[model samples]
Target: MIREFFKHLPASVDPQTRDLAEQQLVGYACTRRPDDFAPLVAHLDSILSPDGDYDEDEDEDGKPKPKKRRDAFFYL
Candidate 1:
């Protein structure tokens, strides 16, 4: 199933992005917890979605906010 998911990624996606997505997918799959799957899918959706920039968080001055480190999750 994970292979199928990676196989279906759009051809237009660059190699680096595709590689990152595949890595994240694999990491998520290793968790084997059903609940973790949704966030993994949501992350992939954000990457593939065309509506807006993937990095949407912003600060008060409208500048892009620094991404917070996910200390609890090694994959992150």
Candidate 2:
């Protein structure tokens, strides 16, 4: 697993294995997924800083609300 690779990467005794883990980490880090980010953007508003953004469903001012911007997220 990636966590195992990461654990060994920092202090592995074998040079070849360490090099392999480094290469694998790079490959995983660069990969991207395709999906809209409204859900995450909304959620991150809480995760990044609690007492988050405006209510998505409410429109007290009578103007249409803007959509949340999409962003990348890694499973690791």
Candidate 3:
């Protein structure tokens, strides 16, 4: 799966790089069917965490609490 592939890749990769890759992939899909990319758009939205207040503390798993989601989605 793409998620697992990403997980196995170097974690040091910049987030912007990941975002660019996603955008390119979505763009590629749009080229195949001009009128039916809505579902793919929704799936992209689901990958992102929700916005607003977040805890700065780390969880028991030592992971930082999820931060408030940003406006990564843009309408053009």
Candidate 4:
């Protein structure tokens, strides 16, 4: 949906501005399902990056921490 939003954004708006808006929207969606989205959310910057896949430090155990899982409809 956000991709479509940016695709249909006004021509007057700059690409950078549109990208920021898309990121904000995606961020909101991620917040809404942090656990479900955590894998993607954790990689959001990379996902949004032009080159993709930035380097990130591992946790103390040198393992990527798993996202906490929660029911998708928990809030309802």
Candidate 5:
């Protein structure tokens, strides 16, 4: 099932990122049960989404503030 999820990842994702994601997924699968799949998928979806919550304030050069990476293992 986790393999299926990795297969479905976006093609635009770079090889390095995809490989890292696969490793992360495999680690998650090892530590979790079958029933945890739904939440795992949802978590992956959130990270993969291009749209993210950002502050209205701009950086010194006027670009939008970058979003910070959240801890993926928070839910656990």
Candidate 6:
């Protein structure tokens, strides 16, 4: 899911994890079909710039919370 990739993307994550996330994102970015790629970009935008309010102090299992919903969906 996008949340997993999003989690691995932050600089705080281990370098190996970030590298794998980057590989997944970069591989998808090279897709020949714009239609297939668009949702990934849109989903990233949704997660990065979510539309609703958030409680910065909130944490789930000691990790920052992932947003609950978004309009876009990414496909592998």
Q: Return the TM-score for each candidate structure.
A: 0.48, 0.28, 0.31, 0.37, 0.54, 0.35
Q: Tens digits of per-residue lDDT for model 5 on 1-76?
A: 5555555555666889777877888888788876685587657856864443334678899898876443333233
Clashes of each: 0, 0, 0, 0, 0, 0
Q: Output the number of the lDDT-best candidate.
A: 5
Best by TM-score: 5
Each candidate's root-mean-square deviation in Å? 10.6, 15.5, 9.1, 12.0, 8.9, 8.9
Q: What is the C-alpha lDDT of each candidate?
A: 0.60, 0.42, 0.50, 0.50, 0.64, 0.55
The list of candidate 3 runs beyond 4 A from truth reads: 1-8, 33-76
Native RMSD of candidate 5 (Å): 8.9
Lowest-scoring 10 consecutive residues by lDDT in candidate 6?
4-13
lDDT-sorted candidate list, best first: 5, 1, 6, 3, 4, 2
Once superposed on the true structure, which residue ranges of model 1 sit more than 4 Å away at CA?
A: 49-76
Between 2 and 3, whose lDDT is larger? 3
lDDT of 4 by residue, 12-55 (tens): 55678667766776777757664564444334433444333223
lDDT of 3 at 53: 36
lDDT of 6 by residue, 1-76 (tens): 4454464343445667556656766788776465776667556545544543243555857887765543444455
- Which residue runs of candidate 4 sit more than 4 Å off their true CA positions? 33-76
- Per-residue lDDT over 3-33 for candidate 3, one digit per residue giving the tens place of the 0 to 100 score: 4224433444479967775675557566745
Which stretch of 10 consecutive residues in model 1 shows the poorest summed lDDT? 67-76
Off by over 4 Å in 2: 1-12, 32-76
